[model samples]
Target: MHSKIFRGIQQEDVQVAADALIAEGLRPTIERVRQKIGRGSPNTVSPMLDNWFAGLSKRLGVANASDEQRLQPPEPVQAAAAMLWQAAMQLAKHAAQEEFLQENQKLDMRRAELQNHEAELISRQEAFNARQIALDETLQLARDQLTAMTSRLEEAGILQARRDREIEELRQQLKSREDERDAELQRRNDDATRHADERLRLEARATANEHRWLTELDRERLEVKRVVSAHIELESRAQATQTQLKTAQAALLDRLNQAERSLKDEHHAHELAKMHILELQSSLDVCRLAYAEIIKSQASQEPKNSRRKPLKQLMRGVTVRRKL
Candidate 1:
């Protein structure tokens, strides 16, 4: 099938077909040659048929040169040859006229087909142009949309970056504030602890002083009682010896005056000890009040769990001292 589709008439094929037509006493025109072969276009068959005819004339001339050595024709044979030549000429002219008419009809049909093909091509070209214009418009619109989307994406990226930076700054500020707060709380705790320790030491010293003063006051009271007893006994002895011994009585009266003066000195010393005890008690009260105020001030500044046990114990000591 592939060979048949691609096969075309060659010059040899045209020559063979024309020779066969001549053997059958037929003119080998383009149509007749194509009909003989059953296939081939006129444009291909025409030139090949003409080439066969030119070669046939040359072969006939060669055959006639050999015939010239045989004989000259008689008058009657010449007259018959002339008539046969005219008839052959008329037959060739009629065949050529028919071939010309057939070629003209084919050319007219081909021209009409070509005109129809040209009209179809024009319509197709116009449609193609319109489609191209539409495609260009679509491409331009797509490019514009892409540009707008790109700009929007860039702006969004910039905004996101700015927000990230702001968030980072805020986090840094919050961290600094937290650090400062922690440091301040630590300092206050250390100060409260130091003040509590100092107050405890002061209370302990004041308590020791108070105990010593109390012990001294008790010893002075015992001395005052002993002196009064001694004076009463000497008075009784002087009354019993009043009329019996006059010189001895003068010595006894002088001794009685010395005893009274000794009693007055003891009373004065007792009063001074009482006054010293009062001053020590007042000083303790002042110390207690000042310590209470310090504790109150510390409580205002410190947490609820700050060292309060020492202050309570100090207040208790003050209350006990007031009672004493």
Candidate 2:
């Protein structure tokens, strides 16, 4: 294949250039020839120029090398050489013209292929741009959704915090109530113990009184025959003492029953309070579990920073929306 760059140059163009250079006292060297022709290959131009020079040398008695001996040709050979030179010039020009046309055809085909490639690239770029825009829209929508979910999570957290605070207060109250109940139970026990001691003291006093009455009765029996009036008075005093002992026993029994009932009621109250406290603790545990699940769900939905809307921002949003 010919050089794509220098294919447009013709043989006649090279000859004309060589002749002009010769007139200017410059030898048609390869570099000069290429400069004169504007553009041509050494391979294509060198052979054509060599043939033209050989034909000329055949026409004249001249040596191509400055040191070489010259030889003369016959007039018939000279005339034939001149004719051959003309024919060779015509053939060289024709070949160059055909090659130039072929090169141009190839160039046109290359340009068309490049244009088709450019069009395909442009379509692909447009499709990529559309896809990028779609991706951007989807990303923005996801961000908005994340923000909304974050706000909801924050609100849930706030409610949970309030609930926790309330539960803590209730726990404190329950603790205080338990302390009071324990103190009251201690006081009731002290009272029951005090009453038991008092009952024992009363029983001891009644027994002593019975022993004294028995001793006095034995003495009165011994004196009954000697003093009836004195014996009757002593007997009446013994009956009054017996009645007081029965009254004291009845009062002691009533006090014991009342204390036992009070103890039962207090125990029942303590058991009910314990049940309520246990229920509160159970509900608190459930609330904690539910809150943990919500947090886990939010974390799974998005990245930490992506889903987290700050509390201040959330509050601001709520205020703004309310104002609007």
Candidate 3:
């Protein structure tokens, strides 16, 4: 029922307000129509007022006919009525002109607001395009760096694999050398043992031969004393006894020379045995030095824990050689 309760004034409401103003004997200008309706803008009221004015002549003709049949008006009253009608028409025209100017000003303001909004949208679109280009370039750089890193990682892997293979080959070679050294050490130890036993046997043999030569020399000295006593008692046959003593003395001297030669030969044989023992000892020492060198090389190449067994074996071999 109230115009204020609605979002905007309707055409029917405007018409009603204009008709009411006419009834009150007032010109239906935009402001007068709004004042009657209680709410409406000039832009909305102007068109409605024009429609009402267009039909006003027909309504006036019908009213005038009815009034003539009822009673004729006096002449002065008719003239005043005609003059009021002309004044109302002129006021309506002026109101319409003012409303048209106000509408034109509002239209110009709306067009400017729309143009500003369009410019803001275009600026935002350009900024978005620039940001997208930067993002794409950054992504490409990251991909290139990733590819280079992957290539380096692959190369490092290949180099590591090659080093591992070479280390394995070195280990195999060291193992073979150790085996050969162990066998040679065993052979040398056996030779040393044999030589030691032979030396002991030769020493025992030399001692027995020396004892036998001393006993033979003592018997020859006793025989020479007995022969001298017999020669002194038998002087009546001095010539034959003297001849026999000379022959016995010559045989004793020959036996002494033979025993001396035998002793010298035994001493020479004992010296040869000692020289052999010395040679065997020297050989064992060489073997020990070579084994130590092998151990040193292995220790440097291998882990400490892995070297323990080989070191123990070398120690055992040295102990055996010492005993020999």
Model 1 regions lying over 4 Å from their true place:
1-94, 194-324
Predicted candidate 1 versus true structure: per-residue lDDT over 241-269, tens digit per residue:
33334444455456555555655665565
Predicted candidate 2 versus true structure: per-residue lDDT over 1-324, tens digit per residue: 775543466767777887788789976654577777777765567656665554555456664654443454678976775555444434434554454455557556655755665566566556655655655565565556655655665665565566556556655765675576567668756866778867565677757755875686576455543444543554565456556555655655565566556556655655565565566556556655654553344223211222144444544543443332
TM-score of 1: 0.32
TM-score of each: 0.32, 0.33, 0.32
Candidate 2 deviation (Cα RMSD): 38.7
**Cα lDDT over the full model 1:** 0.57
C-alpha root-mean-square deviation, each candidate: 64.1, 38.7, 54.3
Worst window of 10 by summed lDDT in candidate 3: 298-307
Off by over 4 Å in 3: 1-94, 190-324
Give, for candidate 1, the lowest lDDT window spanning 10 residues: 298-307
Candidate 3 per-residue C-alpha lDDT over 29-109 given as tens digits, one digit per residue, 9 for 90 to 100: 766777788887655776566667656666677556575547756779756744553344344334434544554465445
lDDT of candidates 1 onward, in order: 0.57, 0.57, 0.56
Clashes of 1: 0
